[model samples]
Target chain A: MGSDRSARYPDGGDTGTDRAPRDGGGRADTGVGRRGFLRAGVLAAAGLAFGRPLLGESAADVVRMVGARGPDDEMTDAVREVLKAKFGDRRIQTGHVQLDIPTDAPDGRAVPTILDIDLPITPNSYVATYHLLVDHNPDIYLAAYHLTAGSGEGPIETRIKMRRTGYVRAIAEMNTGELWSAAVKVFVGLNGCG
Target chain B: MPSMHHDSSRDAPTLTFTMPAGAPSSVGEAKILLPLSVARDAVIDVRALLVHPMDTGFFRDAEGNPIPAYFVNAVTVTYGGEQVARFEWTSGISRDPFVRFPLRASREAQVQVVWKDNKGGVYQQAVDVKFA
Candidate 1:
């Protein structure tokens, strides 16, 4: 669809608005669980496979149910599953890090996003692989990127499709007993994602 | 019969970010019909796209709780160990922010992209471009 974002893309960047601030973003050291999980909401491939959206949970909380674990722990569960499947239930913290995002998105379909890490990722002392996840997307595993000593300390710019407004998390497992995470919940307008 | 006026502006918009086949994920020849060349000192437009949902944290969950808004705040593109461009994301930006721009020339250069959210976590990707 034609959008102001499209016009801004050619060169203008994005529109300017003193968006109202919501909950804290990049709250890295906030507790471990119950809150402060990067898009901690998980999704159940089962629910998606069966078309059971959110399993009667709140739209925001629905994203928390990523892999059929419980209604409130979707995103966390899915991320844990991703880590477990890839890293064998490695040590991950619900509060190791936080995901950075805009507070007021004009639309949802193509909302820009960035995943950040508060810890160091080096050749011998850092996170080797990371997963960028969206809990409520039609597909939970939006894209996973592996990192090495090469990637600098910053963010990998990427975008994902949101079936609806939900949580997004970037789970990073270090070589040691350290797991870092970051999350940000996003809201989208109706018909935001096609 | 009475005429029914449809609110043209009320219609929901559509979004698509599918790139054509054979499109290179990094610098060099890519699909999408844009003429770009990758080389040392070869200024060429690099087509970079990431598929994202870009949740604003403003939408409601199944229970209707508010989904907080979130998006990338900054983006940096570096060529051959040198920073070429930096982008700042805005709320007005679309979900998937794709741009075709000139990559400053560099031999065996890597197009390194780093983006950060409002929090401190960062994500990075490096695309190597070796000019023939």
Candidate 2:
């Protein structure tokens, strides 16, 4: 199962090529050539049928759906429900936050993971809260951390139990009414959610 | 079960900040392990270790005394001047938590982290981004 997913994503190498701009320019461009545009249009239309975001949506908009509403048993939906109750109508972007976990975990009893917030601390704006979530677990919501200006400066590291192969997400809320998030997919051989 | 008494002597929460040694000089006591690649996507992978006991206040000590709950309450991350990520932590987290995340970066930017404990102790650290 792990190998299957790995084949689909193919490490980070394939992601580079897939995201590379067709134009030979140093800047990162989201535009495409005429042929590529037509292909994207077709894909976008199909995406609509599958409830996926269209090409018109920004990357941030697409990324925000990482933990959007899903099945009641889904971890993403559980986290999304909590977030909606906490912060209504606030937009969460995909930057300045990282959720690190192995692509595959042979032992789901304890999977080493990390949630790092790389944004600098400022008097005017700073991180105020953190939400760590795991999908497919009996308890989708894993942990929550609240930080102030006096909290330590370092990433929060720990081991998490996974019931099955799923994604882990870390969401951070700032004092300035902004939220950031990051997620990673992991495949677990043993079920730990029991 | 141990006694449910609180010790007045060890009531204060210990606070410290550290970063990885070597390249990417750090400012102040806080340091971050950021391996930034200058790629077209420019996705920066960030890893940092936080020092905290994450005491749940549920277990009893050797003498059956209840340990006071002392955990990092919250953490926030910001890039440049824009708010990025924030975390609200609970006692379920383990001790000495390690956090890792990725941020989209194209140029040198300032990253900051602020964490607060249950006892109102706040610690803040800042680092500058460097590409390898």
Candidate 3:
């Protein structure tokens, strides 16, 4: 299941990227999809207004255009920037959170990682949000898993793309407003930013 | 439409899947594996798989035209009508992704898994959470 194959999904539903669903059924009631659509539209408009090259020749070029931080700078700045923006002055203690990933990944397209939290998940106290950040990837905020008390205390296991050799950090936000974190370093031969 | 698969291993959990009513397209197939029987308050591992391309805009086709990003944006898990977990993803997720997590068996209810793509396509499946 963790194989590094380049197989793509069939083009059966690939024709609707540009068109917003006219009738989204339940989606129309929640309005969540509308928010996502609006955010994407705003970002696209900003890119156009600035007159900057929105498209890139390659994944690396795309990353460079998004943000141009030196490799050395990313070694520390990547995690720090996210921490400053998310946690701010909140203390992010380590150790309660743990991450399991391969030390050397031949293909950066899919590197499986498991997240385990040594905390309780009850109605009063639980991990509300789990953030996975890639220190060197084009998009540092790789994914976020929102959990509720009903989720039952369980380890989150999934695969992610890594652009290069860097730290993949997992930060958990508790319902009590506490933050916990853990990180793992991985080396990737072929970046999967694309 | 929904497809079902049975496990060969006796220890493997039984999986039940059902598509959401009036879903737009058969965007993809999704499967959720949970044990058929579990002790009260027992913590068990639940594995889920969704068939997706997870395309990044950087990729091009044979004609050298950009594929345009089309990926699963989020996956939500609900237990007996209450949300248990929601995973927000980007193009960074792998193709045909499999996500495994630990789930505590507290009662007999329905376990539903939904996958929402970037283009507002939603695919869902559910299983009965039976306790031993």
Candidate 4:
């Protein structure tokens, strides 16, 4: 679950650059104070131009900083939990599974996504199941698909609703005891979690 | 010709199956396309389109009343009477859901798909698989 905090406060400190003196120097009686104030002013200007929030930090800030860093942590944990419950402690590797989602989605309500397993579908070694998950949604598990000898070799395309900007993941389990996964970060302009 | 009947009432849930071209068919709002056969050790593609409002119950009406939640709860696919895949869905799933997946072609068997909605309605479809 990526947050706007790091992007807001790169240094992760409590110093309010906005409180700097107008002339970029606070009580220039001390040369060090003058330099510090000037630096603060410059940082404040950059933050404002970059659209970083200037308000006091909230609990969300602490949570965002302490919780899972990106979609990989949250999504991987969810997938691992499901797999562990179903197949035990099996190794899951990245690759072979392709997840397609727009980097920026104007409407989170109907973000079109596709999942394709690149491996050949053979009776001896084939993709048997797929799990789609979303980090930061009310329900992390979005949907699951099971493929059999009756299914074709085409990519699965569908529209999924996201609660907010987060990571989306796809995991495929092969019949030969191999699990492949893929994920993508999506920026949602309009929240659709509801 | 098999006629499709649309019924919104919760008491009667409709279920129908349609095979590829040249088979006895019933036209319904929902359709699942499955290949008739595939070469041995080949991959088989399965696709399905289901009809449902998938109302999230979050939106409000003109009078400001919230709509009740109604959507598909579960979908499962089976091959030769063996479980293949199962999906648990939420309101996040798109309206009139369309799903696709792949399977390893092995032998001649029957593929079955079943979906159950929140309103206690169960729908099912099936097709035969021929391996070359």
Candidate 5:
């Protein structure tokens, strides 16, 4: 199983290629050498600067999803179901956001996704929460991110598993209760629901 | 049967793990990758990687047995002793979850990421942000 997982996500190793741009061209070694050294140094410096318990008890904040009325808008039935269940009666406008993803993803195990919201993150008005929804998947609610004004221009970059190929929707709820959404349809090959 | 794998190249810094004495061993180790250099008030990307199966309970093992659902349900990010962001995730997330979000680096502070699984297991890692 481990080998299978590795084969599926080849770049899952500590290649550090993802950090190339952040390093400011200090070193661009793709292999495990100079780049890896700097990565280790950064981690080491962070550890020494602030050492504390990694794990401890915390108040469990469990999420409960209840069904509700779907949004009155123009969208696919699958997406409407999700919107209805997640954000009922909230007018979900279709603008001010975009889903940055590949149109055709050959692999479904890890499809790179970026949700970019062109909104100001200020104390008075900011995107408070962003919900990632897939039209067709084992579960539609991929994730919901809560952000405050301190998050700056909230842009989320992550990898998601698509059971098949369908629309990936991102809905951002502002602090003023304004709901804005954007979606993109993707073609995915190779089932990644495993 | 969660396992921990640290890259051979990394120095393997102090990654504090808090597994209870009699509890089932959960997969340990997570890391926060910050830019080596950052200017004042620059909105930089804070990348985090967590090790977890994120099993969706929809897949079967090699022996045809159903794999139970196990995944990180919540991820909280705190900076300078204040909660900046929190994520509510489901099994739809891929294995070995990796996430990057933009954060304004106003001053030097400690950034901590906490990953909570559905089985009441909490895993976390922290890194200090220093301005260049």
Candidate 6:
């Protein structure tokens, strides 16, 4: 549908900030809910070395954007750093809960795709939100589709951005308040519609 | 997903989409495969993959500041005068978004995908699948 960030998939691709702090357990400290994921505003203070529990008041103050460069550039680095600091020790299993993306986008804009939460989900264990990420996208945390009993019924769908070529990831947040993720790399052939 | 959405004017706007070669289909696998290319009327299978940035435009800028969020607002797909799928979602979308689904296979139907940006820009694609 698109060439640039919205090329392949109509909604674009994954791209989120890798800011915030790491948990003592050494796993990437991601917000399982509205609580802690990096808001696009936190990139400014991210280098200040804020403590764990990213969304808290002490970690940052919502910084107003001052320029045209989108935070998409820092996403992969920030996410990877935090993930290593927070989840370096866990052995993540590759399953339907996670999704991989292909490179060589025909369009950078919307890329069509589906993420299946194949993990058995019950009322107490259903996935709350499916976290989507892309390494080379503008940001590492592409998008987190928040869901509940009404939306979490199955594989969620949407379009995201892709600045260039990179890897895409899918993470599922369980009702128990834990995070699980899977990722795949992409080899882009050219800039989308650029 | 691609097609024509004609207004009262009668000449509908067309749609289009494209993807890189050999990109991975699923995350962690590191590679996407594409072999499902069937004829429009053959009733076969279809598989496709695409890259996405989906920036919320809410992140900070070079000076450590929050940038405005920018994202896609709509998506439409069609094959042979029939609407196959459509999506209207916000940013918060993941990277390298991979979509694998089934459809009533065809070749001449003309597959097109279109995305409308938050700022009112439109990006589209139209592919004539001739998998005879």
Candidate 3, pairs of clashing residues:
none
| lDDT accuracy of residue A69 in candidate 2 | 22
Docking class for candidate 3: acceptable
lDDT of 1 by residue, B1-132 (tens): 002323222454433344468644432221221234455554455566543334455456656566556555666666667665555554333454564444444467567777665555466666777666
DockQ of 5: 0.29
Per-residue CA lDDT of model 2 for B1-132, tens digit only, reads: 013323222332222222347633322234467774444335556665666655556445656677787877677787776556666666545555556655556456788888788998777777877556
Worst 10 residues of 5 chain B by lDDT: B1-10
Candidate 6 on A93-173: residue-level lDDT in tens?
334464534445565555655677667755466666666666554445555545444234455544555545555677676
Q: Whose lDDT is greatest here? A: 5
Model 5: colliding residue pairs? A70-A84
Model 2 misplaced regions, further than 4 Å: A1-76, B1-132
Ranking by DockQ: 5, 4, 3, 2, 6, 1
Arrange candidates by TM-score, descending: 5, 3, 4, 2, 1, 6
Model 4 DockQ, alpha carbons vs. true complex: 0.27
Point out where model 1 deviates above 4 Å: A1-88, A175-177, A191-193, B1-132
- DockQ of each candidate, alpha-carbon based: 0.07, 0.11, 0.26, 0.27, 0.29, 0.08
Q: On residues A1-194, what C-alpha lDDT tens digit does candidate 2 reach at each position?
A: 12222233333122233333344332336555667766766655554454423343467645554453211112343555765675665776666887767888976655887666788765566566667777555556777655544332345566676656667777777777688877677866755433
Q: Candidate 4 iRMS, in Å?
A: 11.8
lDDT of 5 by residue, B1-132 (tens): 002422221332222123347743447568799988989888889999987888888767666677889999999999998899999999888778999988878789999999999999899999998988
- Per residue, candidate 5 scores C-alpha lDDT tens digits across A1-194 of 11222243344332233434444334545444776767766765565443221111122211110111111112344555667777776677666876798979887778999887887567688878888987667788889988888783767888998866667888888889898877777777766674
Task: Please write out the lDDT profile of model 3 over residues B1-132, one tens digit for every residue.
Answer: 001222222232222122357743334888889876678778777889887777767656666677788899888888878878888998888777788876677888888899999888888888887876
TM-score for the A chain of candidate 5: 0.59
lDDT of 3 at A92: 68
Select the stronger candidate by DockQ from 5 and 6.
5
Task: TM-score each candidate.
Answer: 0.41, 0.42, 0.67, 0.60, 0.68, 0.37
